[model samples]
Target: MFEEKRSILEPAGALSLAGAEAYCKYYGLKGANVVAVTSGANMNFDRLRLVTELADVGRRKEAVLATYLPESPGGFNRFCELMGGRSYVKDELLCRFVFPERPGALMKFLDALSPLWNISLFHYRAQGETGANVLVGIQVVDTEMDEFRDRANSLGYVYEVETRNEAFQLLMR
Candidate 1:
């Protein structure tokens, strides 16, 4: 509610949107319309902090993370103080692949290329038992793009590179 309307909703109201977001995220939904029925008009000003902090995280403008810290005093403080990670990664390739929804389809796809490249992200879209699509984010150095292409071709699934999709760049980067 805050992200869209700039109004706060009680916890119950937020849950509907949260559930919808989770479902869309989990299913890699694209260009789909969703409806979330929110309830409860009870508002508290204190809850604004959580909305301000987390809304951006959900929108990909900010990051909220959980890390395992040593079970010792000051662990939480140390974790909070640390800001670490690579600024950018240029080798990731995003591809959309469609495969028949069958018993061996997923494992077969995995077997073809999983050993050759580090898969940074994998998402599946369900289409009942008819077929499915996957959006894969695999890391391949420039020098190895041809080899990666060959391996991807050998998988025999219909696929295309979507690394340059503007919406993806804006939303998932």
Candidate 2:
């Protein structure tokens, strides 16, 4: 099980291939798995591409809070509804707040969240008045996000959706 997990994390390359070859030579390994071998330079280029293109894959695997959204009931609900039924939402992360520095501000913000939605897994507040930016990170499970943009637009939040492929290319290039 551990070997399988590690294999998933391993990059395609000569070292891994060589190791497999050595293991087969010594231990008489037998399997129908196909193997491809390439030079280090080619591997490096491909690896860079994979790293750049799949960076978002890591983000999708783990949720990081984004500092975007206003402190309003309608805003909160719209955000949640936009994220409704996401496949990756095992928890919510709340980091940084740009709301007014007054009593009941935090309460009002919390109240805005629907009970149907899970409590944030992470939370924090901005340091100064000038930094009125609320950062929220939510887990995303579903890769198919056809309605996400529409929902966010309906709620009046400007959002940028970066697919894993595009994110990787942007990062790699």
| Number of the top TM-score candidate | 1
Off by over 4 Å in 2: 1-97, 138-173
Query: Which candidate has the highest lDDT of all?
Result: 1
Per-residue C-alpha lDDT of model 1 across residues 43-96, encoded as one tens digit per residue: 555565465556667779778766788999988767755764223556899899
- Which lDDT tens digits does candidate 2 get at residues 21-120? 7777788768846465533444444465464345445448535577688887688768866876233435332233355555675565555442224443
How far is each candidate from the true structure, as Cα RMSD in Å? 14.4, 18.2
76 Cα displacement, candidate 1 (Å): 22
Segments in model 1 whose C-alpha atoms lie over 4 Å from true places: 1-88
Please report, in order, the local distance difference test score of every candidate based on alpha carbons. Answer: 0.79, 0.46
**Residue 82, candidate 2: C-alpha displacement in angstroms:** 34
User: What lDDT is reached at residue 114 by model 2?
Assistant: 29
Model 1's alpha-carbon lDDT is: 0.79
